[model samples]
Target: MLARVRSTNLAVPRPDPGAGRTTGIDKRPVDRIEVFRPGPRYGDGPGVVGDHVGDTRHHGGEQKAVYAFSREELDWWEGELGRGLPDGMYGENLTTEGLDLESLLVNQRVRVGDEVVLEVSVPRTPCATFQRHMGERAWVRRFTERGRCGTYLRVAVPGTVRPGDPLEVLEPPAHDVDLRTAFAAAMGDDRAARSVVDAGCLPTIYHERLARHLAGEG
Candidate 1:
């Protein structure tokens, strides 16, 4: 019903491998972020005031405009891994509390404080970059198996955002497909993949890959 952003994070753009790539996945920290209602073309675009993304092609765009992870989930990982995970550890631009990000359905719309409106698009697929960021062996596999991959959002309205800003769901999708479903689909759950495609709210960047998975082509 109500959620708040615990922190906002961004990276300093680096060549090939980004500066955020730490042997421990330590990312740059920030207190607040300017949320472009129409969010930038991507994390590196003009709309975003100060954030930098390493791989524009894969990291940021309209559909994958922003990445959000749950503070609660991060805490869970802290307990499981017996280590502290601060905000932005997963390269998430927004660290949220009081929302079940993993269960967020595609097409769900959220209003941040009063300025920004965001549409849930898809689940962030864990990658080698993430593994290297965390410096954990089998990190990708463990993340996938846990099924708590965070959600990406498309900007529908632009406004500046800050830590402690409230996030309210403006709309919820009619379908069952959600972040977990998308992650499961990517992890070889044919039924879940088909469900994601059928929901038809997935971002364009993810379309081809998920479609192939659904069709047994990939």
Candidate 2:
């Protein structure tokens, strides 16, 4: 399940000084991550983004380039072509460039051809920084709350992954409960909320610590 990806465009951050706000989104760069390459950005560490004040968050982390796939995807598919998701998101380690992240079920481990292995965690959640960057009148929160935006992934087996590797799905969607689905269901519906919570598939902040979920919370 390998996949090739390209930064469809860059999300440039412009400062909003007159409004006392800072940061904006620009869809222009093809590989914003590579542009931000201050040096070798990958290694055996958590490829955490966010802790910054800009778009295409790949700042302050160890593993490697923390990219966010936008309204693009690998020019190929190895499985189901699910629903249409977001067009542009502000923060992420690897923005599918276009593919759908929701289809990757949580715990349905993905191995980037031994280059990288990450168990699906959840889609990236929007924050104040996102709203500030996008400046779309709550659009940031809406996208995240609605499960359209992609999120973060804590690297389990740290390895190098580029834009031309296959995004192999090591396992299929389990019980139809991927992070994207869980997020969409949990936020507004109590029944779906309970299910997502019970499964601990919700974001770490939204998760409920049941005995079952504890075992896999690693």
Candidate 3:
């Protein structure tokens, strides 16, 4: 089934107390986001529209410009966490529906609305900020084991996007590497992780970590 953008969220770089440290992970909802062809600072810099990211070292850039989480997954998390996970609560720029986000391949291209096109980049790695945000004990471990980490996208085409926009998959990469596989590799399996790096589908943002894993340095 074709997926649709259920809701869109944006926020300027702001201090997030709930971020549990000096992290800019807290994003508030905004009306619209003007997307642009990705660059070094596509999601975190001034040129992009309404959406802004807190951390550049690990969060923003062409490879992870737009973070997307499926409402379906959120529903599941809500059940597990025993509470409602409002849209944007996870700091996702787009809350999608009808898409199997976990299965999307790295380098897959998806068209949103009439202009914005996004290339799937990588699976989000849950961090301490995320655990603090949710206030759940063992949140990171649970989230990692659950393996439903949402996807990050690089803006391939620029345009304005809003809630309820149409979403279409333009193409999927010709590789076996998927979000879960990469996640597992990063966690420990050098063989699995090296495959993802060798596939050349994942952006450069992940190379350093993968290299460390392969070299027993991570």
Local distance difference test, each candidate: 0.76, 0.47, 0.76
Q: What is the lDDT of residue 83 in candidate 1?
A: 93
Error of 3 at 109 (Å): 0.2
Instruction: Give the TM-score of each candidate.
Output: 0.86, 0.57, 0.87
Q: Which stretches of candidate 3 lie over 4 Å from their true place?
A: 12-14, 17-24, 41-48
Worst 10 residues of 2 by lDDT: 74-83
Model 1 has an lDDT value of 0.76
Q: For candidate 3, what is the TM-score?
A: 0.87
Those runs of model 1 whose alpha carbons end farther than 4 Å from true positions after fitting are: 13-26, 37-47
- Residue-by-residue lDDT tens digits, candidate 3, 58-105: 766676778889899889988988998888888788889998887878
Off-target runs (Cα >4 Å) in candidate 2 are 8-70, 73-89, 141-146, 173-175, 202-205, 209-218
For model 1, how does the per-residue alpha-carbon lDDT over 1-218 read when each residue is reduced to its tens digit?
46898887876554336444322224466877776543435544423566665655456666777788988999999998899898888878888999998777888899998888888877888877787678788999999999999887877887777888898877677877878888898788888877878877676657788897666677
Model 1: lowest-lDDT 10 consecutive positions? 18-27
The local lDDT score (0 to 100) that residue 13 gets in candidate 2 is 52
Candidate 2 lDDT tens digits, 190-214: 5555566666554444465332344
RMSD, every candidate, angstroms: 3.2, 8.3, 2.6
